[model samples]
Each structure stands twice: as C-alpha cells, then as structure tokens.
Target: MSLLRIVFKSLRQHLLSTCITAFSIALAAGLLMSVWVVREQSRRSFTQMDSGFDAVVGIRSSQLQLVMNAIFHLENSPGNIEVEDYEKIKAEPGVALAVPIALGDNFKGYRIVGTIPEMFTHNEYAPGKKYKTAEGRLFDPELREAVVGSFVAQKLNLKVGDEFEPYHGLDFDEDHAHDETYVIVGVLEPSNTPADRLIWIPVEGLQFMSGHREESHEELSAVLVKFRSPLAGKTLQMKYNQPDGHLTMAWPIGAIVAQLFDKISWFDRILEMLAYLVAVVATGSILASIYNSMNERRREIAIMRALGARRSTIFSSVVLESASIAAIGVVVGFSIYLLITTTAAQFIRAQTGMVIDPMEFHNVMLFGPIGIVLAAALAGVIPAMKAYNTDVAQNLVPVS
Candidate 1:
C-alpha cells in the first residue's frame, strides 16, 4: 500500500482520537479568530467615530460621560441644560454653530434625538463629509416627522411614512408613551458611526412631548459645538469647563474615546493571553492524542519493517499521519471560526445595534492558521521518532 493509504488506515483505526484532537484545535482557532476580528473592528469603529464637531456643551457633569452620552448617543444623559444657556455659548466669540441636542425618550433601546435639520447639513462626519440620507430626504424641522438612522431603520424595520410613539426616558414605560406619534419622514445614510443607531426628531418635538408649561426654561441635554479654529476651541473649552461655569465643555470625542480604550487595554490584553493559552492546550491535546497511539501503532510499524520498510519510511509515514491530523484540524478550525463570527456579527447588530462586517478579511487571520498547522506538525515529532526506532525482530513475535 502507498504511504498515503497507510496513513489513512492508521487514522481510521483511531477515529475517535483523531476527531477529538481536531475538534480541540478547531475550538481554539475559532476563539482566537473571534478576538482578532473584534479587536480590528472595534479599532476601526473608534478611529472613524469622530463626526468633526469640535466640542460638546452640557450641564456640569463628567466630561467623558457627557461626550459619550451626547455625541455617541450611547447611554445615561447627564441631565439637561437650559436652552438659553446653550444659546449663550452659541453666541460666544469663536462659536461657529451650535446644534441643539435633546434626548428624553427611546423606542426599544434606540435613543431618540431631538435636533434640527441643520444637524445633517452642518455636521461633518469627516473633514469634508456631511450626513446625508440613503433614500428619503432629511425630515423637515417644521413637521411632526422623525428621521431614523440606517441601523435603527433596519433593526426596527421602519420606513418612510411609518409612525411610532416613543416611550419616556431610556426605559420602555407604557404609561409614558408620548401622546402624539411621529411619522418616519426620512432615513439617514449609514456613516458607520454610533449615529447610525439613533432615531431623530426636531428639538421642539421632545419639548412638546414632555408637556412643559409655557414660559418654562426650555432645556436641552447637550449641544454640538464647532469652532473656527483649534485654538478657539481650546479657549472656549477652558472657559466653559471652569468651576464657575454651569455647563462643561468636552472637546473632540475622538480623544475621550481614546482615553477610555487606554484604560481598558489591560483587560483586552488579559483576554488575548487567555486565547493564546487555549491554543497551547489545543496543541498539547494534539501531542497527547498521537503519543498515546504510538504503542498501538508499534506492532504495525514492526510488521511493515519486516515487509522491508526502512526506518526512514516508518518515520516519514508516522510524521505524515500526524501532520494530516493537524492539517484537518486547521480546516476544521477555520470552518468553526467562520460559523461563530457570522453568528456573533448578527447578534451584535440585533442587540447593541452595532454593525460589524464579519465578512471583511483581516490580515492576522492569514498567518494565524498556518501557525496552528505548524504546531500540529511539531506535536507529531516525538511519536514519529518513536515509530522510527521500533524493533522489527522483537515486535514481529506474536504475544502468548
């Protein structure tokens, strides 16, 4: 029989061990691939998150928390600031434009932002890029209309002309559903930012929904501020962030997010180490599976030697057998990796409303699987050497 046929026969004889070892390697590969993809996608998401606004103005609160909640529309707003106070900042020396932000409601966990049509026009997602709709136009500030983000529209399955009532605050309070429903007049184009997860209406809509009495202080959760220059922004941030200032200024959300990531980088490092440790255990499993089978395979090796097989042939066949298992392990590992990542992408979109493209190819995955293959080849070394040293005369004698 050819070397390939012999290898297949030996593997078939220990099918359970072969499957177990390959499965262990596959599980390790899947986990490692998942961590790599998440890391890359998260880095991309953070790097591109800035919408070119220079600063955020909100009621005196944690600057980091304010920016995260306001600009990202992430969570837990830092209360509200008087619109009159915001206007005061808008009229400040270097202020270019101030877009009002009011958030007091949600629909199924997606934040409902109350801002003007100008937000899409004046705001820059990048240096020269502005927000635009994928299909319908921007909602008119004069109408009782809503504009949902691309991810929001898809998750809620909303379309232009659809109408829905928002619940009070971040919670889904049936008792606090707004008296009036808002029609979906438009859907913003996907810019791959947290903005893609919001539902927007005119600032007046939120004020009206809250039933504030006439002449009451019109309050906003925050304001998006752009400056004429970076120096102007720094000066304004210093002025507003002063202890005497009722409102705080948070500049350049990109920087705040960077600090946040830096603080948590150690946790990410821990996860990475754990993933590699699992891979090491997978390699050990390969070693044990092949090594344990050596005794059972020795008699077979002796018979082949009697059939004129050289020690080199026995060694090569044994190595090829183990290497084949390792190769199969790599294929199975990648298959599992693909399956898990695709499912995770869908789950993340459904739960967190974050769009992650698992289909996007990441470079690390290229060299990673090859490393697993090489580790498997190395795992077979000891057993292959033992097979090479088998005694032909001693093992050819039948046991009593």
Candidate 2:
C-alpha cells in the first residue's frame, strides 16, 4: 500500500478523534477570520459614511453625539438650535448648502423627520448621487405629506397615498398619536444610507405636530451643512466651537464617526486576542491528538517498517495526515464563516441600513487559512518524529 493509503487507514481507525480535532480547528479558523473581516469591513464602511453633508451645526453638545444623531439617526438630539441659527449657518460665506431638520415623532416606530423639499431637490447625499423617489413625488413642504424611506416602507408595509397619524416623540405610543394624518406621497429609492430608515415630512409638520408645546416652535434640531472647501471647515469649526458660541459644529464628519471606533478600539483588540488564543489552543489540540495516538499505532509503524516502508515515508505520512486534517477544517471553516458573517450582516443592515457583503474577499481570508493549515502541520512534527524513530524489532512482536 502507498504511504497515503496507510495514512488514510490510520485516520479511519481513529475517525472520531480526528473529526473532533478538525471541528475544533474549524471553530478556531472561523472565529479568527470572522473577527478580522468584520472589523476591517466595519471600520472601512463607517469611516466612509456620509450624510450628504460635510458637517452638522447643532446646539452645543458632544460632536460624536451630534454626528450620530444627525447623520446616523442614532442618539437623541442634544438640544435644539434656533431657526435664526440655521439661517446664519446657511448664509456663511463658504457654506455650499444647508438644510435644517426637525425631529420629534414617529410613525409605527420609524422616526418621522421634518425637512424642506430642497433636501431632495438640490442636495446630493453623495457625489453626483441625488436622492430619487421610487414611487410618487417629494413631499409638499406646505402640506401634511411625507416621503418614506425604502427600508421604512418595506418594513412597515407602507406605500404612497397611505396616510397615518404621527406618534408623539421618538418612541411609539398608542395614546399619543397626533391628530394629523400625513399622506405618504413618495417612497425613496434604496440609498444604502441611514436615510433609508426614516420617514421624512415637511419641517413644519414635526415642529407643530399636535400635543407639542407651542413654545418649541421655530426651533430646529440641527442644520446639515456642506462646505465648499476643507479650509471652510476649519474656519467654521473654530467659529462654532468657541466658548461663547451657542451652536457647535461637527466638521469633517468622517473624523467624528472614526472617534467611535477609536474609543471602542480596545474591545476589538480583546476580541482579536481571544481569536488568536483559540487558534493556539486549536493547534495544540492537533498536537495532543496525534501525539496521544502514537503509542496505539507503534505496532502498526513496526509492521510498516517490516514491510520495507522507509522511516522517512512513515514520518512524511504522519505529517501529511495532520495537514490533510487541517485542510479539511479550513474548507469547513469557510462555511462557518459564511454562516456567521451572513447573520452579522443581516443584523447590521437591520439596525443601521448599512449593507455588509459576506462574500467580499479580504486578504486575511487567504493568509489566515493558509496560516492555520501550516501551524497544524507543524503541530504534527513531534508525532511524526516519534513514528520515524520507532524500533522495528521491538514493536513487530506477535500480539495475542
């Protein structure tokens, strides 16, 4: 029999342990790749996230909080800025565009934001990518008409011409539903941005929605600003961030978002360390499994030697078996990675409207599996050496 056939026979003899070891390898490799891919992809996507605007001017508050609230639709508005503040920011010398948004209600748990029609008519959420309606027309700024985001429309079974009462505040409440029934005039196309989860109405609708205090009139949540040049951001940031300034500006929006990842960077490092530790433990398991099986296979090794199998051949077979096991695990590990990453992608999309493609190839996918297989093969060296040094005469004795 060839050395490969002998290796296969030995593996078949200890199939259960071999399978268990391979499974451990699968878990380790899958976790390692998943952590790496998710971290890299998330960092890349979030750092590049944009709200079609370069900065947000809002009441003095945390820059991160303002960006999250205005751009990501996360966190509560820190406070409200006056309409005069919005006009002043819009008329700033270097300001290219400014759109104010008012937020206070929800329709079926989806936030209903109030903004002017100019946001859709004039602004590009990204370079040359203007918002387009999939269904009807943009909401009339003077009427109680709303434009629903694609994700919101899909999740809530909403369609153009459907009318619904706005619920007071961000959270949905049955008793606090406003008397005003806003018609959904349009459903926006999927922009793959945070806007896809919102229900947008005229700015006046949200500010004056029933049950809202009259004193809060003319107060804007934030003014989304786009500057003409980088220099403009510096000029504006210094102006708005002054100690005497009533409004704060979050300039270079990407930097504000990146700070979130920076703060949580230690957590990612911890996860990566745990993944590496799992990989080390998995490699050790391969070593232990093969080494512990050595005594039982000694007689077999002796018989192979008697059959004229070279010591080198026996050694090579042992090492190859370890490598083969790892190879199989690496194949299965990719399947596990697909499963994990797909679920993660779904959850992330549901929460943030950001799409993460699991099949998107990364360099780690190539190097990570190769590294695991090599480590596993190295793990078999001790057992392979023991097989090579087997005493032929002593182990070839007849067994009862």
Candidate 3:
C-alpha cells in the first residue's frame, strides 16, 4: 500500500484520538489567526476611521469619550454644548466648515441625531468621499424629514417614504416615543462610519423634540470641524484646550484612535501569547498521542518488515499520518475563523460603527497555519523513528 493508504488505515484504527488531536490543533490555529486578524484589521480600520475633520469640538470632559461618542458613536456624551458654543467654534479663525449635531433621542434604539444638510454636503466625514443619497434627496432642514443610515434602513426595514417617531434617549423602548413623527426623505449609502446607524434630522427639529429644554436647548453633542489648512489644528488645540475653557477640541481622529488602541495593546499581546501556548499544547497532544500508540503498533511494524516492507516505508507512513492531522486541522481552523468573523462582522459594525470584513485577506494567511503544520511534523519524529527501528525477530515471535 502507498504511504497515504497506510497512514489512513492507522488513523482509522485510532479514530477518537485522531479527532481529538486534529481538533486541538484546529483550535490553536484558529486562536492564532483570530488574534492576528483583530490586531491587523482594527489597525487598518483605525487609520481609515474618519478624515477631513481637523477637530471634534465638545463640552469640557474626557477627550477620548468626546471623540469616541461624537465621531464613532461608541460612548455616551459627557455633556452638551449650547448652539452658541457650537456657532462660536464654527466662527473661530481658520475654521472652514463645522457641522453641528444634537443627540438625545432614538428611533427603536438607533440614535436620532440632529444635523444640518452639511453632513451630506461635506466630504470630511471620510476623506474625499461625500455621502451619496441612495434613494432620495437630502432632508430639507426646514421640514421634519429624516435621513437614515444604511444599517438603520437594513435593520429596521425602513425606506425613504417611511415615517417614524423617535423615542427618548438611546433605549429601544416604544413607551418613550415622542408625539412628533419624522418622515424619511433620504437613505445614505454605507459610509462605514457611525453615522450609518444614525437617524439624522434637522438640528432645529431635534431642539424642538420632547427632551429639549433651556439647559440642553439648541445645544449640540459636538461640532465636527475642518480647517482651511492643516496648520489650523495647532491653533485650535493651543487656544481652546484649557482647564477653564468651556469646550475642548480633539483633532485628527487618527491620533485619538491610536491613543485608544495603544492603551489596550497589552491585552492583544497577552492574547497572542496565549495563542502560542495553545499551539504548544496542541503540539504536545500530537506528540503524546502518536507516542502512546507506538508500542501497540510495534508488532504490526515487525509484521510489515516480515512482509518485506522497508523500514523507510514504516517511517514515512508515521510521518504522513501526523502531517495529515495537521493539514486537516489547519483547514478546520480557517473554517472556524470564517464562521466567527462573518457572524460578528455586522454586530461589530453596528456597535462600534467600524466596518470589519471577515474575508479581508491578511498576511497571517502565509504563516499561522504553516507553522502549525511544521510543528505537527516535528512532533511525529520520535514515533516515526521508533516505528522504523522495530525488531522483526524479537516481535514476530511474541504475537502468538
């Protein structure tokens, strides 16, 4: 028989152990690739996150929270800044454009943000990419029409002609639905940004909503600002970042996100280390599994030699079995990766407003699984050599 046939026979004889060995390797490989994917994909998403905004102007509070809540929609607002404060930021020197957003309501759990048509008119939400109306025109600020994000439309089954009343705050409760209903005038193409989950109406419309009051009246959650030139960012930071300043600016979304990831980088490293440890355990499992079966197979090896099979043939069969397990395990591991990433992709997008493509091929493909196979092959060395050295004279007499 060929080496593969012999290998298959041996593996079939030990089905349970073979499955356990393959699955352990698969788990280790999946864990390794998963960690690599999260690290790389998140890094890429962070870099491309938001562009064209020089600064995020908001009430004095946690700068990280301000940026995350205002741009990414990942956190709650620290506080609101009045419309006057928003306009003041817009009027600041070197400020070329400022889009105001007022948040305090939700439409079935999706946030209802009040912003001017400039949100659709500006390319700053993403660098050089303007928001395109997928179905209808941008909502007129004079009316109570709304524009929904792609995800919002998909999740809520909303269309341009649909009209819905928003609830108070972020909870998806019907009891808090306000008296006023807003018509959906437009649907935005997927921008892969937080705005995709928002129900954007006129800033004036939000101010007139039920939660509005003098304290939060005409107040904005944040002013997304763009400078006439790159130099304006330095001026905005130097001037407004003060302990007594009513508002602060967080500029160049890239830096803010970098800082955020840097803080959690250690956690990623720990995961990577754990992945390696799993791999080590998987290798040991393969080694122990093959080693323990060696004694039982010694007589078979002796009989193979008695039947004129070469020592090298027995060795090759053992090695092939180990390598086969590794190969199958890697494929299983990749399948597991696909299942998880595909399942979580939409969820991650909805929660963090960052797009994660599970199938976006990465460099990890070249190395992670290949390393597992090599480790598995190495794990078979002792077993393969032991099988090759079987003594036909000593073992053939004992079988009876």
The candidate that achieves the highest TM-score relative to the unseen native structure: 2
Q: Lowest-lDDT window of 10 residues in candidate 3? A: 46-55
Per-residue lDDT tens digits for candidate 1, residues 286-358, read: 7788888888878888989998999988888777777787778778877887887788777765544456777
When 2 and 3 are scored with lDDT, the better candidate is 2
TM-score of each predicted structure versus truth: 0.90, 0.96, 0.93
Residue 148, candidate 1: C-alpha displacement in angstroms: 1.6
Candidate 1 residues lying further than 4 Å off, grouped into runs, are: 1-6, 212-217, 398-400
Q: Better model by lDDT, 1 or 2?
A: 2
Residue range 1-400, candidate 3, lDDT tens digits: 6778888999999999999999999898888888888777877786567645767889888778888887877788888888888778788889989988888899988999888888778655665788778999899999999999998999999998999988888777887788898999999988887778888899988888875676666678998888888788888887889889888888777888888888999999998999999998998898889989999998889988999999888888888888888888889999877876766676678786678787888878768888888888888888999988888888888545
Off by over 4 Å in 2: 1-5, 398-400
lDDT (10s digit) by residue, model 2, range 1-400 = 7767877887889899889888888888898899999888888777788768999999999998988888888789999999989989889999999999998888878888999988998899878898899999999889999999999999999999999999998888888889999999999999988889999999998888888888568898999999999899999999889998888999889988899999999999998999889888988888898899999999989998998889999899999889878887888989988988899988777778777888999988999999999998898888999999999998999555
User: What residue pairs clash in candidate 3, if any at all?
Assistant: none
Leading candidate by lDDT: 2
Against the true structure, candidate 1 reaches a TM-score of 0.90
Question: After TM-score superposition, what is the CA distance of residue 123 in candidate 1 from its true location, in Å?
Answer: 2.0
